[model samples]
Target: MVNSWWRRSARALAIALLLSFAAPALAADDAADEVGYQFSTDWTGPHTAVWLRHLARFMKKPDIHGLEIGCFEGRSSIWFMERIATHESSTMSCIDVFTDAIEARFDNNIEVAGFSDRMKKHKGYSQDVLRKLDYASFDFIYIDGCHLASCVLTDAVLAWDLLKPGGMIIFDDYVWALEKAKTQRPKVAIDAFMTVYANHIRVRERGYQVIIEKLAPRSDRELVGKPVVHSEEWEKDYEKKKKD
Candidate 1:
């Protein structure tokens, strides 16, 4: 068993060294350059590019593991694999509800990019697959499945379970405009999750996408899900703080 593990580890290291040379620099000349990838996808193109750059910092490190919810045309997934390729032990799992043309594009892009071995693709709604994932196993997770507040919150809560200490979670489309209801946006769900884990949450970026890091959780405590703050309580607390 020890020899087998060592051989596997050694093989992973060799693969990582080779991939490091193949991944591109996170920055793109233009947001539209996503077309340069096997599949083209953009949500706030310039911001997405910048967001990728921020992720680059964490991904460049060794032995990183990642999970992504929603692999539309494999755009962000491609970027992620590029960085993961740099580290031998790095691997990523992506969950997507594959149907119709998007399925082919996702498969083709990942295949053509030479990442078939480094990535594991899960075909299903993120909620179901997330339940089966090991706790605190991923170094990074990107949530982009459904834009609805309930769906986004569900993904965040579950992803929280899978994220490792000092791991990062990227919530895409935070400010995406869908109708006029603020509650309908990703920000609503992301903020609610933030309130639940306020002490452990570190905000990294807030714009078209929100990237935040999860600080190590204490062995003695647990977060019970959504924050306890209601509008009335929050206002009262804020007002009290101001008067004091």
Candidate 2:
């Protein structure tokens, strides 16, 4: 009788121990299903979602590097982190001046997005935080900071210098925002870069975004001394078509 009781007690203990370990594994699986390994954010609209899905497909290989500029509150940064975590070998680098460097033009938008506290947590977007990251070294770059033409241009140039050969660079907000001044927006800078670098760069599936692979070493050409004639013609034609 005592042997029977002992056997039952041992079985109960073994079952409890197995369950304790299994619970966490089950919970982790559930969490993975909830978020998958993809990057997601409340700010991701239809275009952005489609673009990210396409990017994920393009990056199916094992040894891609990534970089992100203007990591405001880490929504996109966290997405990159998730991607890196899932891959056995991948790295990302981020850059930003962080503290209203261009102008506090979007203060209300940032606040409304509920990123004020999150932004404060990361040393206000200094490159120092990125310098010591333990993950894989960056092979691709994303630029989304300082929408002013000069600032955007500067950031792109700096990122270009850091970008590896065959790596890709992504820019945010390539479309015009009516509320912001037309002259110095992010799209303006991207357009300027694309016009000169069109030979080496290609537009990604995302209409506003572009992807460039560093094929051969290249130099930054001076911004065209004159306004782009092609853009004016295209814009004029677009407006005319719209009116009709």
Candidate 3:
């Protein structure tokens, strides 16, 4: 038994290392690149193309629906539309507090990609826009909005309730360090969400992006195994500690 476990762990590690090195090369062949979507910047394409391309094979369906919190220049949005949401019935909704120029560019890019009719643009803050969206209506969601910890946490929690069972969510810039304080970044919030919701979702990848698939409904709070202590026991302990 011990030998089998060790062998399995070693094989998993080897596969992870191989993919880490090979993904960048594979991304070059992604079909989205051939569309020539107009972009003011290329922040997400290189890091996300390999995974998104892989997902397209399994996730592309006629009735697919996608949501994105940030759609800067429609780079990732176009990729999702052209690659993953390829069917005529497929649709994508994007939420971003857009400036006039940015919105114009995004509009033009989506038009060029022939997704203007199928795309829904929400011009507002994600927290507000997310609340208004229909629950469990999305099969795929990409979260790359405000990088602040608070915003990321809010998005994750709300988005969880909206994700259909077996649906996937991708949180971008997990290792970003532009902010001086560690508490201000997305990783902290992503870690907290993953820890609390560990029983509800299966983590698919953990790199620049944190990808997860919903295994159960968010309303299902059942833990998978025995917890260290029940809530009643924890409450009693807390009261005792306060007296001590």
TM-score winner: 3
List model 2 lDDT by residue over 118-178, tens digit each: 3323333423544444332446667776677777666665565565555567777777584
The runs of at least 3 residues in candidate 3 whose Cα sits more than 4 Å from the true structure, single-residue gaps closed, are 1-37, 57-59, 218-244
| lDDT, model 2 | 0.53
What clash pairs does model 3 have? none
lDDT of 3 by residue, 1-244 (tens): 9999999999999977875564323222343343554455677656656566436654557888889999877877877876787788989999999899999889877886677899999999999999999989988889999989999999998988778888888999888995558668899899998998887789988878888988985444433334455689899999999999
lDDT of 1: 0.76
Q: What is the C-alpha lDDT of each candidate?
A: 0.76, 0.53, 0.80
Worst 10 residues of 2 by lDDT: 32-41
TM-score of every candidate:
0.72, 0.52, 0.74
The local lDDT score (0 to 100) that residue 62 gets in candidate 2 is 69
Candidate 1 ranges beyond 4 A from true positions:
1-40, 218-244
Models, CA RMSD each: 13.4, 14.1, 14.6
Candidates ranked, most accurate by lDDT first? 3, 1, 2
lDDT: the better of candidates 1 and 3: 3
Better of 1 and 3 by TM-score: 3
